[model samples]
Target chain A: MNAIGLVAFALVGSAKAIRAEFDLFGVTVVGLVTAFAGGATRDVLVGRVPLALQNVGEVALGLLGVCLAVVLYAWLEAPDDRPITLYADAIGLAAFATAGAIVAIEIGLPAFGVVAIATINAVGGGAFADLLLDRSPFILFEDFYASCAVLGGSAYWLFTALAADATLAAAACATVTVGTRVLALSRGWTVPTAQRLEAVTGE
Target chain B: MNAIGLVAFALVGSAKAIRAEFDLFGVTVVGLVTAFAGGATRDVLVGRVPLALQNVGEVALGLLGVCLAVVLYAWLEAPDDRPITLYADAIGLAAFATAGAIVAIEIGLPAFGVVAIATINAVGGGAFADLLLDRSPFILFEDFYASCAVLGGSAYWLFTALAADATLAAAACATVTVGTRVLALSRGWTVPTAQRLEAVTGE
Candidate 1:
């Protein structure tokens, strides 16, 4: 399988893990949504009817992801099951962000629009997915995760302007993005907050 | 508020009622997605950015819907305590489908594209919304629901061409849509099934 395919499989697995509380039907639904949610967002932002529904591979793969998730959850049976949800969500965001920006820039979007499209593509599905599942993944409390995605997308757009070193820049962008996410996870560094001294907090 | 605002708020409340198990954030997400999912979809399909973010009112109203839903759910808990999810999902779908058709046809889409776009605008969000929340909504299981949305949208499109009366046709479309949905719910009717009976019977 290609990189995208591998990542998609991981997504299905993670979806199952996340939806362990749900029934089988519910698990299937979660798997499909998590697997295709980002892709659907990317396609919509780029004015391309969703490609996930256009092919059987994606659906089959998503089901497979559900199965894997079920098995993995059964085996793990603990909340500390590594970074299944986090990694899958992050990778899905990055892949879709790349796809969104490329499609936007390809269709002659301006710089700012490209950035906005990329950001939406990256976070839109995950946020919606989390909300539906009664959680708020990255946006609710994850610091700087969304920022990394936007930065990566912007970097990808910038690389388009390069004449010879475009691929190199794209690689750099991916590394920077994935690295930031991993660092945030490993170092326990969150997006900074501004919940400073409140007016209600008296001396 | 305008008619659209009223419809939007009602749809948002309905969405929350349908997705009853969701949290406050989840309710807001579902409400906003249900309320704006149609028009947002129309804009994206026609290569226009979603207007939800452009107009601050839409967001405020959507949040208001969430608040309304929170209050309604609380009140219902104290009184009727009936499962109104099916009803709310239906209302949301009906409104989105009709409005989506209008948006698509107005954008000069051909008959088929308009029908497809309108139907997606109507059913996509609701279906996926339910799927995300692990709810096997009747529309997915009971059947005849999405098909009616398509039919209503198509009727509206056809009527617009023959009568040149936008309001009349839109009303007709909405009527057919709601009627079909309501009858289906009341009578427990469904569309055709193509499953393998032999396999089920072990023939």
Candidate 2:
């Protein structure tokens, strides 16, 4: 599951790097950070050395994903459009949200704790990647991005707290996140910008 | 020492936010993240719940720093210039570097681990703030920033490993980091950018 998420995250990171026209080294750096930073953040908060640092396999998988992204970039004539990027991001978000929430739950964190960890873990990598590239983090404004993670994480915590089956809870978490994201994309839903509020207040 | 670093970091973050024309909430968010993110990152990687989350005093200190920054901004007619910002940054870097190195050493991390953790803890907050504001992270290109952290961390580790007194080692670490940064500023030292390599390699 983590390996799959790594690939998805790498692709998202790589695409962003390519859009920024970063060199190969830059691409790899961005991809690796995006793929591992979330889990690393989670592990660090839990008082464990990040698996990304301890496990050779995780690092290798991240590298493989970056290399594959580079290869794909070389092969493709055109850059990816918005839809493809959003979909990939959604998938990665759901994966990490479920994974992070479960970890939080296992540690007996409260509902808020579970949601916070899950949301941060799901989106933190992309945020790090964007920040490194000198862009405003996507989580700050990207449509339904961190929101999905929050909702999914909360749902997961709710289900688990209510004595739901583990697999069932996990599935529900993933489904809600992905489904909300897809709907938000199709419906053009967005978290309102502060600019709108300022205009309304006329301040 | 950590509290001082937190306050200093909040000032830096708040200054950046003011420069970016962020509203009050944005300023507070940026300030809090800047003050806490470094230590939080360190704690998380070490598999411990972050002190920022666990300790009420720490949170209160962080808030106080942000409020102070906001008040300062309101009182001041002009935003800070580059030199003032750099000087404040240098102080923060020195403090966090020494503290982080001590923690890493006490935890029995290897020399490399000590350096990694120390350097990251020293500069991670500023990096996060820069990224959030859509500016290049200072450590990536700022004169002798992370380099100072590396040197300081290594110096601390070496001193401790060689049976030097703890206070003396910490003083040496801070002095080296701040002294180097000050010298770098006075001497107009800058990190050599990769763009220079592009010119040489014609890539």
Candidate 3:
């Protein structure tokens, strides 16, 4: 799950940097940061050393993802909004969210903390990448991306609260997150914006 | 030190949000985030619960700063880049850097980690606020602000390595950070950008 999340997020982040016309170095840095930042943050919150700093294999996986992204970009000519990349991104989000929920649960955090950390683990890297690219985080105002993680996290907490086995809870969390994200993508579902709310109320 | 840093950073963040024409709620959120984000991140990195989450007094101090910013904004026509605000910002940066260094040292982090955390603690909030405002972090490419934190953290580490008392080291760190920042401001100092370096080297 960690390997899949790292590679997928790195690919997603590298695609964004490529689209932004960043140099190769910038693209690679963005990719690595996207892959590692979320997990590193999770570890810090749990009072552990960052996995990335301690494990070279994880860094290698992220670099492999960056290389794949570069290859895909060259082949596809425009891969940023493509279906393949989007699917990979969804998979990554689910994987990270599940992983985060497990960690938070193990650490005996409350339900809110579990869900919050899960969402943070799933989307923090992308948010950081967006900031580096000189833009507001898309998760803040765009589509239904982060909500999927939140839902997945909540599901994990619920399953655990109901005394489900750890593996089952983890699987449920991942499935719920990926399913919701894919469904949202296909159905064009979006969270309402503040501007939209104001318009509706005529205020 | 914590109180001073929180209030100053909150005021600075609120002033920026006001300049960006955000609503009052947005301004308040930005202020609170700017004041607490860095310290919270540092705490997380050190494997402790966030100070903001643990203490209501800290939150209140940040809110006070936000209120102060709102009042100044209403009175001064523009408060974003005023001398008073700039000085306050420098002082906040120094205080946060010192605080972070102390935490990292207490946690037995190496010199590099100490300096890195100090810089992060000093600038993380501003970077986050910039992200919300849809801009790249100024520390990544702008003036020499974060560098002062780096220098101060290094000074702290060096003093400790030389067997100086912890109190003396901390005082030196804050003094160095603030002094350098004020000097940089007065001299209109800026970090050399990649473009500038490229031009100089005729790359």
Question: By TM-score, who's the top model here?
Answer: 3
Residue B185 displacement in candidate 3 (angstroms): 0.6
> Which ten-residue region of model 1 chain B has the weakest summed lDDT?
B192-201
Q: What is chain B's TM-score across the candidates, in the order shown?
A: 0.74, 0.86, 0.94
Q: A85-144, model 1: which lDDT tens digit per residue?
A: 566555655666666676677788877877777777666655655644555464657677
Best by DockQ: 2
The best candidate by lDDT is 3
Ranking by lDDT: 3, 2, 1
Q: Show where candidate 2 strays beyond 4 Å.
A: A1-4, A52-68, A71-79, A82-85, A161-165, A193-195, A201-203, B1-31, B42-47, B53-127, B134-203
Tens-place lDDT per residue, model 3, A1-203, is 66877888898888787776565545666788798888888888787966664465777899888888777775576665788778878998999999899999999999999999999899999887887889778999879999999999999999999999999999999999999999999998899988898999995
The B-chain TM-score of model 2 reads 0.86
Per-model TM values vs. the true structure: 0.53, 0.61, 0.62
True contacts kept of each: 0.07, 0.31, 0.21
The better-scoring model by lDDT among 1 and 2 is 2
Cα lDDT of model 2 by residue, A1-203, tens digit: 55677877877787779778999899999999999899888877776668888889888878877877777777774333446655766787899999999888887777656876888789889888987787777566546568788889989988997999989999999999988988887997766443444445555
